[model samples]
Each structure stands twice: as C-alpha cells, then as structure tokens.
Target: MSSTTMEASAALDGFHPITRQWFTEAFPEPTRAQTLAWPAIAAGRSTLLLAPTGSGKTLAAFLVAIDRIMFGLPEPTLSENKPGVRVLYISPLKALGVDVERNLRAPLAGVRAVAQREGVPFHEPQVGVRSGDTPAAERTRLNRQPPEILITTPESLYLILTSRSRDILRDVDTVIVDEIHSLVATKRGTHLFLSLERLERLRREDDPQRRPLQRIGLSATQRPLDEVARLLGGAEADANPEQPVRPRPVEIVEAGRSKQIAVTIEVPVEDMTQLAQPVVTGSAAGAPQPASIWPAIHPRLVELIRGHRSTMIFVNSRRLAERLAAAINELAEEELALAHHGSIAKDTRLVIEDRLKLGQLPAIVATSSMELGIDMGAVDLVVQIEAPPSIASGLQR
Candidate 1:
C-alpha cells in the first residue's frame, strides 16, 4: 500500500463508527479498488473508477457519496416544498437498479441510526427505482414526490428527463453513471451524452446560484484511460468558454487478487448411449438437448461444488441455469444449493441473495444475473462453464 492508500484507509476509518460497523458487517474488508478510489471520491471531485467485479467498487462510489451527503459541507436551506432529486444513480439495466437498492439499504440504515443517536433531525433519504417495470402509480408518485436519491437505468433516465418529471432533476447535486464502460462504445452512450448535456443545461437554468452538478462514472474495466476520459467528458465542441474544460479524473484500481478464472475444457465421448440419459424428466422428451448435456456435465459440476465450500457456476444461459440447478439438486439431494438467474422473480432473487450471504447456501449455479454487485455471500471460487465472449465479462466474473 502507498501513502495515498494509507490516508484513504484512515479516512474510511474515521467514518461514523456505526457506518463503519455496518460496512464490516456487510463486507468484512474494503477491496483494493475501494482503498485507492475513496479519497478522490470523498473529496467531491468527479472521478471514473475502473475495477473488476467482486472488488467492491459499487460500495466505494456510494459510500463516499453518502458520506458527503451526510457529513460533508452542509447545503443552504431551501423550502421544504422545493422537491428535487439530489442524487441521480443511472444504470444500464433495471435489474442492476434493483440490486443497487438492496445493496444501499445497509448503509442507509446505518446513517439513520447515527442520526438518531446524535439527536439530529433524522430524515431518511428516500431512494426509489424507476424502470420499465415500475408501476404507473409509483411513477406518478415519484414525479409528485421525488426521492433524495433516484436509482434508474439509462433509458429510464432519458425518459424522466424528457417527461413531465423533468423538474425532478433540477436540483440533482450529483449524477453517478454506473457501468459506464458498458455504454461507452455504443449508440446508447452517444445518446446518453446528449441527455447529460441536457441535464447540465437544466441544472444551470434551474439553480444558477449553485455550481454545476458533480458527475461521476463507474466501470469495471477501461483501457487507454485518455480515450475513456474523452468519451466521458463530452465532445470537444460542448466545452464552455467561461468554465475550464477539464475532463473528469479517472482512477483505475486493479483487484488485490489476480483474475480468478477456473476453466475446464471437456470433450464429450462420441458415444450417444450412456451420455443420453435424462437428468430431469419434467420437460419435453427432446427439448434442445437439455441445454448443458447434463448427464456429461453434472458429475464435474457436482465435484466442483462438493470440493469448494462456496462456488458460482456461470452457465451459458438462463435455460441452462435452471436445468443444471435441477440436475445438481437431484444429484446432491441434501446439500444446500440453488439455481439463480433473471427469470426468477425479484423476491426470490432477494431470498437467494440473503441465503448466500448467510452462508446457508453451499453453492449456486447462476447466469449473468449473479454477475452484478449483488451481495451473494462469499464466493470462494467461480466456475466458468464456457469461456466468456469478452475480457470485460470475464473480468466481471
């Protein structure tokens, strides 16, 4: 660790005891990425953090933001009726938004406890998610009573900006673009640039007295930092004459441990007789070869699960996730394990996540649904059944 890391670690140590306790309870220690990124983040400087998944970048970004909101310089008093969004957290996927909300509850609860003990007027910062799945009534309520922090997807953010709820963004003090690298090379990011420009214009128009909203971008992996910075800083023509055109500073923190990828390449025997046995009988007789060719794959999967106390098996698709999980359950019969994927309902996902965190689940066979920053217990090892298409996806796993 360098001097900067030491200072940051100390700063993190100085966080309200309850908040620190909450962090430890949730995740025992900060990842190397968190240690390197927190100081700049806590200073209110716009930053782009690049670190692999399972490295705690999500909590690092929000922890600093929440600390600033709760303990940084106080804001000037405004009317209670002046309803506006203070923090805008945008993700590319609605599922990511749901995961973010669940992850944030721990720190939010800690903040509330601190306020209560200190005798400060505790206003629990309201956080709500808006996406295609959000109900009409909830959307209407969000417009009428915007939360202090709004967690949403890029498309949903664009929709909110263009809709009647545009005023909700007028007072946004910080905008966090999560999974930014996921959008950078695509048309969606190009479109999002326009939205961000619109947001800056809105902030200037609505609250001319305050400074522009701070912009922070978070990603798992980014190469050629300068190019990533330029993409995030908006096109050259948009640079303002009055304000210095400084690209947001980006910090890349590699994981403490090198990439943990356990790959197993198995060539199936040419015999179609023994390998053709059905692992589960609920489905059609010849339904697309049961995804994983379970009879050949199950034994290896069972071996991996039995060997490791905690393991995550990333299958090719959701259908495979369910199929492999069913087969594993049948094989083990008594071990605590489950199938996890997007097809499962939100409530079920939360339950599985909780069980994983509690160390009650020995292993979970999942798809990309488990790839995001959900607190799914401690994974001792990750088994990639097939090679991920890109370095980004592989790093995330």
Candidate 2:
C-alpha cells in the first residue's frame, strides 16, 4: 500500500476488525469529518464537529461509539451489572431523532453481519427512543430494561432527568448532541444547557470518581465557532478566587465546506398588481373574492417535480403545506406529493418520509418541521414558497 493509503487505514486501527471490515465495504473511504474526528473521539475528548449536510458527520459521531460498545467492553454481551445506558444522543427535533434511529439500523446490522460471517461473537446493542410521541407501554419497557443507546430530545431529556427515568442515565458516559446550532441561541438552548449541568450532577452523585461526560456536538451551519464551542464546553470556575470561570476543553473539527447554492426567481404574472385581481364567477354574487396566486404556483411546482428526481417544497405554515401538496398532486394528475408538518400524525409523517426516501413520492411539501437535519435521501431540489423563518433555518433546508 502507498504511504497515503497506509495513513488512512491507520485511522481505523483503533476499531475492531469486524467494524473496520464492515465500514470499508459499506463506504469507499472515511469522509473528511470522520478522518478528523475519530482520533479525537477515540482519545476521549469532548469535540464539536462542523460539516455540511450528507458529509457523514452523523456516522463520524456514531461509528466510534458503536465500536466501543461492541468491542471495547470486557464482555461482548450485556451482563446484569452492565445493562445501563452507555451513550445518549440528543436531537432538537423529533423527526430528526426518528430519522436517526432509522438510519442507525444499517450500521448495526452491517457490523453484526460481519461478525456472524466470520464466526465471531456479536453483541447487538439495543437502541431506544423516548419522546412525547412514545407510547406509555414503550416508555415503561425502556425504563425496565434500558437500551445501551438512548435517543431523545432536549425537553425529553429534562423530563427524564427529573423523573425516575433519571436512574437509567446514571452510567451514561457519552452524549452526542445533533444540530447544535439550533439549540445555542434561544431559551430552549438555555434549558438544555441547564439540563446538561443537572446530568453532570447526577453522574457524579452516582460515582464521584467517574470521569466527566464526553460530549460530541454536530452542526452543519454555525458562526463565530468560538461562542458555540464555549457553550458546548460548559463553564468551570477556577481555583483562584480572582480569576474568572473558564469553559471546559473542546476540540473543534472543521471539514465539509458548504456547497455553493444556485438560486432562481420566477413569477406567474408579468405584473405584480395582477395577483390582486378579483375572481368573477356566475354562482358567487355576494362578494368579490381576490384571485388565488396558488393556481399559478402549483403548475410550476409540478413541472419542477417532474424535472427533478425528488423535490422538497418548504412553506411557512401547515395550512399552506397541505394546500400546496394537494394542489400539486391534482395538477400532476397523480399522488406525486405529500405534506409533512407538525400538525400531521407522527406515523403518517413517517410513512411520507419513507415513501420519499424510497423514491415512491416525487415531492414533499413541508414546514419548519423538515427544516432540521432529517436525511431526505436523493432530494436534489428544494423550493421555498416564502422566505425561510431565518438564515439558519434556510441553510438547514
């Protein structure tokens, strides 16, 4: 092998043979983010990884944790004494959390397949999700026999810490917070930080000598990296009375530069004033209703959907999403689109997401609910009906 090839392979040396084999076969090579992050994470550093969407940033954060659970442990199988949760993944959005849970299945199964083929013992780690959407029975089951990895949201984590579920988190050594940018600037961010501090106290109360939690934060869009780093690494007071408190140490990995975006602006009417023209109909004589701009917009959306393999339409509200989706399907003369927003049932939204991923649906009209890091497989076109809520929100789309 060439020197460069040898160097790249060295990065995977810390992982188990089964993990390394499965990864090599699954992906051509480690992404830039993964190459830079695995070493720091394996060395047990709290790290904040910045990378663009679809750059394998999620796998960079997850693969090592999975390896540790499978191979680094003294026993391959979970014993009665070692059954507590070991890794905690926190996502800001419920859809993103659910997407992550579905995505993890591939890697877990890949590694397990490698082990079985080689006649090696494989310990399949269980994963559990706890959120408002989780059924009561499922929550009780999770509490009784906690999974090795727990995926949750900020509010759910706070609730877990406050209730009896907190016990399941006592042995958690690693916390992976996805989409860190969304949570660093608002009251929600403040609440999550407070919860992190509380979790630290809970861990220490369980075992005072245990090492501090290892936090790994992932974000595709952020500014003034230092500020986000400071938040990721919470504050600690110095021993000296006069000195100000300092933030904990956190390693920053920069890779995956944002792709240059192309924009096009189109309008249905030649003159802006034409949009306000009143609709005249034979049956409606009581009042003159302004004409709808949607009639003009729906056809263009259908045309775009036909042109692209997959398209995502972002609107400002749920009502618009539903209307736009139905209009597009009617205009296309087929069920070519689906609406995804907070108001939709969780199971229904999941089915829509699956259909889009499988290329069964050509388009999905969504609101801020799809603005986070949910993986939309093969979606190459994004149409924004109105301006996004903010610049960060737009970038997420």
Candidate 3:
C-alpha cells in the first residue's frame, strides 16, 4: 500500500486500519474529540482543539501530523537518508514529552509497515526529545543530526532558539504547541511568543520561497479563542495583505460525562490528641511549635500511603516529600513506599516510574513529578495530602 493510497482510504473513513488498530490497542477507542478533530487536522489546516483531560486530545493532535508526514511526502529514493526537522512539538512538561514519545511509537510502526509493503526504502522518521534532562551526548548529536520530529518543553525550545543550534528550526514545517493553556497566562508563554517570532524570522531567512510553517496549538482548556489565535500567529495573522489569511478552525469536545472518581480522606487519630493539648499548662510552658503547621501535618501522611494500591501523593515541598516517604516506609507494613520528586536522582525516578507502570510499587510518594502525562498505567487511586492551589495543577494529579 502506498502512503498516498493509505491516506486516501483513511480520509474516506476518518482513520486508516493500521492506525485504528494501533489506537484500539493502546487505548480503548477514539474519544469524541478524536472523531471531530481528525478531519480538520487531516486537511492540513492549522487547528486549536479544546477538550478536557483524559479525552485523548494529545493523540488527536499527533495522529494527523503523523499521517501527513507519512502520506504527504513522496517516497524517498535510496540516496535520501537525511531530512531536517519537519515537526517541532513543544510540550509544557518534560515528562509529557517522554509520554508523547511512548504514545507515538505505535503510529510510527504503522507507517513503517505501509512503507515496507510498497518496497520503498522505509526510513523511520526520527523522533528525538530535548529537555533539561536530555544527556549531553544526545544534545550534541541532535544538533548535528536533527530528527524529522523534535519534542521538547518551552524552556528547552527557548534555550535552543537562543543557542548556536538555532538553525535547526529553519526547516521546521509544522509546530505543535501542546498544553498552550498552561503557558498562555505566564511569563513562560510570553518568552515563548518571542521565541516563535524568532523562529518565524529564521524560517523567513532560510526558506524565503516556502510558505510559513503551519502552526497547530493543542490545549485541554482555553477561553477567548481570538486571543489564542493571535498568540499563535501575530496580529497580522488575520490581515497579511500579501498572503491569503485563512484562520485555522478551533473545535471543542466535551467528555459526555465525568468519570466517577474514588477519593478517601485520612486524618490522624493519635496526633489529634497531642495537638489539642494546651501550649501552657499551669507553671510549665510547653516548647512552642513552628508557626507553620507542616510538621504537624506529617504524622497524618501515613494513612495516605497505605490507603491505596497504586497511589501518587502531591507535596508542596521537596524536603517534605523525602521526609514523608521516609516516614511512610517506617510505618508501612509491606515496605512498598518510595519517595519521588525532582530532587531525587533522575535514574531513580525512571526506575520508580517503571515500577509504578508495572504495578510493582504499592505506593509512590511524589511531588508534581508524577503529574502531567507520564504513564504509570491506570492508577486505582490518587491521594492529595494538601489541596492543589489551582484547578489546573489538581487536574494533572
């Protein structure tokens, strides 16, 4: 099957058989978001898709990009081995980039299968992730040998645009900004805007004859669509007299109903009595506790660890994360408790993530590290020791 034929067949039915098989295997079925968003994306239109968490919005955005890259380009001859970066995927979190890489393998495999049947020298489109934790050797290699698709966080992208390797963005044909809502209200987004402008400047300089790179913005939630459109492209996006301005369409797919979540709240039984004891008793004045009550809150953490089979506990501070883990281990019956946060070594975190994915870890006490899109399989329960400051942070948990 030629790539062109594969795309045409999929276009008639909204998704290719291979892709549909992969999707069914990785996830149960395409959500409502995927159903509506796929066509607009397949048409090569710039799009802003809005849907709630756990709605498969990420897959919706990437499937189109993968299909286009697979089908839109001509089959490469034996001599064609190198292709510059074609897709620049900007994720808000480094963890999400890793998760996206895992999710993309299935689709890539599907493309390769089709290419092989056609007797084309199927070069698997190289996908690389760049982040703060990306090893020094990989970073250096990426500069010399750019991937067909590059996944990175905004901060990493900002650093790349400002660094000597800025030229890598020159041939970028598409830019997908994942989690745009997370960046839109902060200085990070402000900095990213300038970086996009810089990228546009570079694209103009390097490929003056080519059309501007297609911009696709992905978000779980956003309001005031006009502002986001301008943020993606400048004010001149709608009114570039020289070029025809066809604004990308935005689509929203709400989950039919909220999934029923099981939540449990734990409180200290023994410590409550001590806390109720007065600071001053007759002639003896008790030593004063710290003004902040986090220490007092520590004893209540054990119930959180033992309450669920697979759990993630969000802590406000890294020190507290370690301390709570240590405390939980001391109190836990099965010795399955482990601390996970940014302060922990990267190698250790990866191991913990693996264990959690396999359901080997009974309880993994973590800060925001486990949040975002790092797949730990389906967690039976999530315990928030403290209230998340914002709804967005809470959603990630």
Candidate 4:
C-alpha cells in the first residue's frame, strides 16, 4: 500500500454519495484516465482522453453524464430526464454503440439499486440505441419516448440530427465520441464533426438556458492530438498572429505511455515445414495465406479456443475471416466460432456480437471490422495473422 492508496476513498468525496459508493465498489481505485477525466468533465469542460484499450475512458465520460442526469443537471428541481435526449454517445460502428449499451447496464443497475437502498430518490435513466440496424418500429418508440442516454453511430446520429425527429435531441447536453481516432483520420469523421456541430447548434438555439454541450472524446491511439481535440468539441483557436498557436480550451488527458503490453509468441508445433511446407515461411505472407499450414493451424486454434473463455481472431481480409472461421469450426463438434466482417448482414452481425459478448460463442474470426471499441466482454486472447497496419491499430486490438 502507498499514500495514494490510503487516500483513495477521500478523493471520491466530491461525487454524489451513491456514485462515490458505486465507484469505490466497482473500481477499487480510479484509473489514471479517470482521475484526469472526471475532474475536467465534472467541471463541464470539453475533454479528449487518450488512453490505451481497457483504461475505462468510456465509463469516465459515461459516469459523469450519468451522475449529471441523475443528480447534477443545472435544473435543481428536475429528477427525471427532460423531453429530449440528455446525453448522446456517438461511435463509428453500430456494433460499438450496442456494445456500449451492454456495458452501461451494469453501472446503471448497480448505481440505481444502491441509490434506492440508501433512501435516495432515484430517477432511472432510460438508454436507447439507434443505428442502421434499428427496426422502424423501435426507431418510432425511441422518438415517442426519447431516452436520456442515446447511443448511436455517426451515420444514425447524422440522420437523427437532420430528420424531423431532430427535436428529440434538442435537450442533449453531453456528447461522448468513442474511438475518436478512427473518425478523425477520414472524410467520414469530417461529416461526424459536422453532425456534432449541428447538434450543438440545436442545443444552443432551442433554449437560451440550455447548457453548452459537454463533449468528451475517447481514443486508444491518436497523433497530432491537439487537432483531434479541437475537432472533438473545441472552438477554433484565436487568430493571434504574433503569439504561438495555443490549443483550444479542451482538457487533454493523455496516458498512452502508461500502458504496458506483454506479447507472447506461441507456435502450435515447433517446425512448421514438417507439417506444411516452405510456403509457410515465404511468398504467401500478407496476401493469400498458404493452404498447406491451415490444417495444422486450425486444430491448434481450436485447442487454444477450448482453453479460453472467449477469443477474437483478427485477420487481414473478410475472405480470410470466413475461411479461417470455417476451418476452425470444422474441427469442433458443432460450430463454436463464427466469422464477422462488414459484409455480414447487420442483424446477423448484431446477433454474433451479442452471442460473443454473452459468452455463447467460443470465438469470432473477424477482420478490421471488430478492431474498433466494441465491448465484447473479455477476450482471453487475440490471434493476428499479420501485424496490424500501424502501432496505434495494434494497440487498439
């Protein structure tokens, strides 16, 4: 034990008593990202949290919003959610949005239950998800009784912001952008920022008393982070030609250096040439994998899967994802693993995602599609056929 450990309980005093208790129970102590993120976000500052995977950045943003919605909103008299959305969470992937909703249930249920037992008046916040996969009837339900927390992909959000249903977002006060790095590197990200800007404008114009949207961006990997921070929510910096360019008023919590990755190399059997041939060593590396070594590899993969609760096998292409998944399941008594790529039907993909998260599936062989921040519970191991395109990507996986 250290001085920091000794005083951990006192540090959470600023949070609502129920939230503080839940925080202490769920997380033994605050993660570094949490320590930095909560204070800034609690103070209503736009924040960019750059931490590696499993650092709890999503919860850092979410918990603050949850606290506000439950107890910290500007309106002291209001206990329940307002007419429109209160917190809108945007992700690049529909699957990621669904994944976040699953993770939120634990905290929502726990915190609300604790609040109730403590004789605290509690207003259970409703959470709804909208994406391309959402059925028309479900979409209508969300509009009729909008949830306080809405999880959505960029495209779905854009549609919501632009549609007649835009009024549903008029009260949105907090917007969390997860996997911010994935969006900022492309034109799609540009479109997302525009949507965010539009949503902000709606909040501002809808009511003069409405609080400014508190934006929080979470990323596993980012470079030129200041630019991303500005895009996350910061207004353009002042045009003081004489002074050095100052970053906008966004609090950046970067703990990328603190993460440590221990990588282990495991070969099924020592000499691969005995099992397959020279092709395993050369010529078929990044392109098409050699058919020869797959037979030996699949059984080892099945063995590895049997040893783990859940596994995520990342391959270079969808074709390879299908082949590898089929190969691995062929060795099993029944289909224990499934292939997931962009080409899969949206409903099917959601089912596979749910099954994987619920521990119903042994493993999923996926392409880069699964690489984004979808909370598929815990994966015992990740198998990569080739090194990811970049260090950032590899870290995210």
Candidate 5:
C-alpha cells in the first residue's frame, strides 16, 4: 500500500490497536456505504449515507466517532467527570435512541478491552441516552457525567438545546441523525434542523477551534439528492443573521445498488377468509382489516416465525402492533414472541429489543418501530401484516 493509503487504513482501521483488530475480526470487508462514507466523515465533511436497509450505514457513521473517542478523549482523574459531549445522535424514535447503545456495545467493549490490555486509557466515547422515558435522576446524573456520545430523540434534543445543561453539548463536533427519511419531510425535521442550528450556535459560542458540526444522516429513501444533501447540512451561518440563509453542502453516498433482496409476501395456505375478516368491530369492521384481521392469520404468523431464526413482523400502527402482538403471544405461547410499538412501556420494549438481538426471542410483532436500522442481529424473515403507507415506507421496512 502507498504511504497515504497506509495512513488512511490506520486511521479508518479503528485508530487504535484494539479497534483495528475488532474491525478485522467483526467485519472483514466494509459495506459499500461504509467504504465511501467513512473517509468523508473522518475528513470533517457532512454526508448523507443513502443505502439499503441492512447495508451497515449505522456502523459507517458510528465507527468514526468511536475512533475519535478511542484516540482523542483526554485522560481524566478518577474524581473528574468525563469530557463534554462531542457526538450527538438524533433518532426519530425513542426506542431507537436506546437501541443505538445496544448497537454500539461490541465495538466499544472490544476496543476498550484491547486498550486495557495495553494499559492505555481510552475515554472518548462514553455514550448515554436521554428521552422522555429517561428518569429525572438519570438525566441529572448524565448531565453531570456528560457522555461524549449522546443518543436522544428530537424532542429530548430540543430540551437539551434549550435547557440549563445545554453546555453539556457545547463541544459536540458530530451530529448523527439516523433514519433521516422518517423525518426529513415533516415538521419534526423542521424542528430538528432548527435544533441543529441551535447546536451549531452553542458550539460556535465556546469551541476554541470554532469548527462546524459534522453531520451524518442515514436514510433508506430520499429523492433529489442535492436537496436532501442540503437538508443534511443545515443552513449556513450568516455574517449577518438577518441576511438570506446559505445552506451547507454535503456528499451524498448512494449505495442503493443491486443487492440480494429475498422478500416473500405470504398469505394463508388454506381456510383464510376468517383471517381476512376484521376481528374487532366498532363499525362494519373495527379498524383496518390487517389489525382486526390478525386472528385468522395467528396460526400462519406463528408458523412463519417458527420457521425462521428471527422474524420482524411489521404492522402499521401502535394500535395494530399491540393488538396483533397480544394475539400472537396467545397463539404462539410456546414461542417467545414479544410486542414492540410506541405505546408499549419503554422497559418492556427495551427488553424485547435485547431479546431479539440475543436470539432469545423468535419473533417480535412491531410497527414502524422496527423499520429503522436498529440492529436486531440477522433477521431471517420479515412479515408485514398489511401494506405499508407508501412505497418509500415499504422499502424502508
């Protein structure tokens, strides 16, 4: 390898002896998205990684942040609190906020273990999640200890941007918005972009280097590449705040190439009219057919799950997710099936997520909650209860 290639390899190969080994062992080859995305991000550029559902986009964004932490965080005294937050991860869902930590466990642990063996103090990427579900005590404690990598929802991020402890984020150099397609077209995205600008303002106020925040957006679907790129990189600062706003530019990495997508839409093998009928009745039919129609398909759902090592059964809404999940739980009593939706209690949802990742559960009946690329290990199958709202949503799921 040339000198420059060797240097880039060393930097991107985890930036530490332990991390490099972890990368080699865990992923022998970088996915297309990671291959193109990492160098741009590491070079302090904003990027939008548009890849297929399981293309390792999350790792592409996270590994660079992890590298910075492993090699850059200052060593602190035992009594001192960890350093200021430098990477803020914004997930549209609260469930996903905590899921990022689970997704991060291996690289962080592996690299840290290697450092410990070599007597190096690795401290940069202490991660924490803050959301509505985050307890007051936990929130207070995190603010005091200030994790360098913070995973939070847009709402929680707004609170952080406006709260007294906002300074905890003043040093943040990177902001990762996962599942950007879910938010980019809505008011949530608007609020989030404003929050991004606010985050920029906070950093500009105190950072000695005065560097702009490096943004990495992971998306399943997006159109008009330049617009999405501009959206990824928020409005630029004005020499005068009242002047016309200029937006930052971004490098769009399109990894939506030919890949092996094995999707089979299955229906009942026989005696299926009952499964098609809406089981719940408030009107001619209670809610949508699929939500109310789950009873008839309960057997089939269970059978499909039994056939696969791990299955993510996608439904449309929280209501349907809960109802079908409950019915599936009863039908597949022997199988460890769990309900996952926005309405489910946070603790229960978290437990289900962990179970799915560990392969302890065969199936999880979920709504759009499972749509985002929050690692659940290798899912063998995906069964959507009904058609998704749009082609984009379907592609994402």
Candidate 6:
C-alpha cells in the first residue's frame, strides 16, 4: 500500500510466477538488498551487492539465477536439447560452497511446490557442489549430468577451467562470487579472475554471439568498492584499435550499510600485569610461557556457553582450537563443545557443523575455517580468543 512496499513488490515482477509466489509465501517482504539487486540482475547486468550479514544478500544473488534456470529457454546450440550449467557460484571457502548448496534446496523445493499446486509447468533446478572434498565418483556424475546451478571454490573453478570439465561451463551466463573481500587482494583472487577470463573465452568459442557473463559479487565488508567493481566486471575489448580496453559496465547496489553490532570485551583475570604465572626457576628465556589467564578463562567460557543457546569460539590456529575444546570439555566433564578446523576430516567437520545448526551442539572451538559466511544457525554468542588476523576476519566471525 505504501510507496516503499509498492517498489519492493515491483522488483519481483521480473521473476517467474512460481518463484514470485513461493518467495511471497516464504518471506513477508524482500530485504533492502534484494529489492535493489533483483532489478539489475533481471536486466542481465553485472551487479555488486554490498550489504551487512543476514541481509539476504546471498538470496538476492541466487533467486534471479534460479528463476532464469527454471523458466528461461535453452541455448539453441545444445546438441540434444540437454541443458548444461547456467549459473556458477564461486566461494572462497569449500564449507561455504557446501552450505550454499544445502541452503538452495529449500527455495528450489518451495518453488516446485508452488508450481505443482497451481498445476503449471515447473523445471526442478538441480544444484551441485564441486570441491576438493567431492569424491571422484561424485565428480564424474556431476560431469555426466551437469546441474543447472554449480557451486564451487576459486581453486576448484580454476581446476575446472583447465581440465575437460570446462566444456560443461560453456553455457554459463551468471557468476556469483561470495565474500569478495577475502579474494580481492590474494593470489587466489588473481587466479579466480584469470579463470573467469578463461570461462569467458570458452563461452565465446562455443557461441560467438552469446553475451558476456553476468557477474554478481556479494560482500559485507569491502573498502574502495570502485576497485572491487572493476575486478568483478573485469575489462572489455574496445572496438577501436586506437583505444585501450575499457572496464565492463556493472551496477552497484549498496543497502543496509548501517547495522547494530553489540560488542562486549570481558577480562576474567583480576590483575592485568600478572596475567602469566611467575617465571619458572629453570625455564629458558624463550620457553613457552603458561597462560594463567586461561585458567580463569575456561570457567567463564563454560558459564557463557551454558547461558547462550549457541556459541562459536574462534582462535587463530588449529592447535589452539584443539586445546580450547579439550580444556572446555575437561572443565565441563562432558562433550559440550567440538573443535573444527582444516585439519579435521571433512566428514567430521560436516558433522560438527550440522550439530551446531540443529541445536544439538552448544559450542564449537574453531579456527579461521568457521569464520566465513557459513550459515551457523542461531549463533547468539561468539568469542574470539585473541585479536583476529585482520578487521575483515573479525567482522566475518
């Protein structure tokens, strides 16, 4: 009824009927990011959506791609009318890719339900995850029957681009990069940018008339967004030989920039300078000093865990994660918390993640592995053992 409500409703006009119905039924209204992002993406433009966490930025990038796959027409070049992947989702973390794949099931199923109820045609979208953790057999199956939406990490995407698997990506029209800040300054980011260029080349070779890939980048914290926008859109070859290449056009959507963050710094120890035990009589000068603060820290951690529904404790290394979890269990006399890090087996890590999401686990001692945009459900409390490696890392946790 209001003007803002009217604009939000108008943004959904470009989506498929089933998608719109399912979305309207599932959510009361779209987030600010979604309201601005859908229109640009629906218009086949590259988009960089900057918004705070929990602002539905992921869904803002995903829903438009899902709608296109469900109702859009297949490329004329398909040999036997078999559709290959059309949406490529790149995440810096494998866990985040897997999480996105899992999260997509609800929306896909919801849209399918809407179509079935209305007795209309519906193409069930298939989503797949390809990462180092993917088994050989699973990878083979994915190649044999490519999903409409493919989720992968930058490293995995590079591998796919180099190998024969790249053929399956010739029809991809959309690329969604998650956590753009993590990759913008790293070798991995450069590798991913080169891989995207490779992907563009592959698509052009397949069909010279096809349009350039539509890029969508999602990030919560990124400074000098102009620089990131150039990376997302890359560059385009200019028609005139006298001129240098120009940056591709991209739409920027910044929404929900102001968010409420409650931070409390708690020190359990009474004395600041006496945080460590007195120097041992026979210890060497550089010997590992025992942290007396931890003795007081453990009980406080337990009390906080018991008070909160779910908690994530982040440390800098895997060793610290193990030590913290062991200490917490030793004090609690139960397996109230588990350690999660890269060193842990993939199956075990997934079990821990699932447990935390289902409210079966009260706390997790994790390294940077858990700091990304993995949807940890109902995480009301987060404890960082020390200052994070960077501001971006701290914000991610």
Please name the candidate that would achieve the greatest lDDT relative to the true structure: 6
Between 3 and 5, whose TM-score is larger?
Answer: 5
Tens digits of per-residue lDDT for model 1 on 299-373?
777877888778888877888777778888888777546888767876787677777767788788788777755
The pairs that clash in candidate 2 are: none
Decreasing TM-score order of the candidates: 6, 2, 5, 4, 3, 1
List TM-score per model, in order. Answer: 0.76, 0.91, 0.80, 0.82, 0.83, 0.93
> Considering every candidate listed, which one attains the maximal TM-score?
6
Instruction: Name model 4 segments beyond 4 Å from true.
Output: 1-3, 6-11, 73-82, 206-211, 234-248, 257-309, 331-336, 345-347, 354-360, 387-390
* Residue-pair clash count for candidate 1: 0
lDDT of 1 at 309: 71
Superposed by TM-score, candidate 6 places the C-alpha of residue 287 at a distance from the truth, in angstroms, of: 8.1
lDDT (Cα atoms) of all candidates against the true structure: 0.72, 0.87, 0.70, 0.81, 0.79, 0.88
Model 5 agreement with the true structure over 276-377: per-residue lDDT tens digits: 654455686457543333445888887788888999988888877777777777776675577788877888888888889788988888888778777766
Model 6's TM-score against the true structure: 0.93
Between the candidate structures 1 and 2, which one is better when assessed by lDDT?
2
lDDT of 3 by residue, 128-236 (tens): 9999888999999999888878999888988998898887777776788887877788899988877877787777774455565567777664666667866775423
Q: Relative to the unseen true structure, what is the Cα RMSD of model 2? A: 2.9
> What TM value does model 3 have?
0.80
Model 1 bad stretches (over 4 Å): 1-6, 9-35, 52-55, 71-79, 120-123, 207-210, 235-294, 330-339, 359-363
**Model 6 agreement with the true structure over 1-397: per-residue lDDT tens digits:** 9988998999999998889999999999998899999999999999998988888999999999888777776663455556678899998887888888888989988988898899988677789999999999999999888888999989888888889888888888899999998889888899899899899988999566678999999999886788999998998775688898888888888885776678999888877787556555444766665556788999999999999999999999999899999999999998889999887888899999999999999999998888878897689999999899998888888
Q: Which of the two, 1 or 6, has more TM-score?
A: 6
- Model 6 misplaced stretches (Cα beyond 4 Å): 238-242, 275-278, 281-292
lDDT of 2 by residue, 1-397 (tens): 9765676677788789999999999988887888888889889899999999888889999998999887776321235764778899999988999999989999999999999999988678899999878899999999899998999999999999999888888878889999999989989999998898888888878466667789999999987778898888786665598999877899999886858899887887677787688767557655767877777788888889999999999999999898888888888889989999887888998999889988998989999888788888689899999788888888888
Local distance difference test, candidate 5: 0.79
The model with the greater lDDT, 3 or 4, is 4
* Off by more than 4 A, model 2: 1-7, 74-82, 238-243, 258-260, 276-291
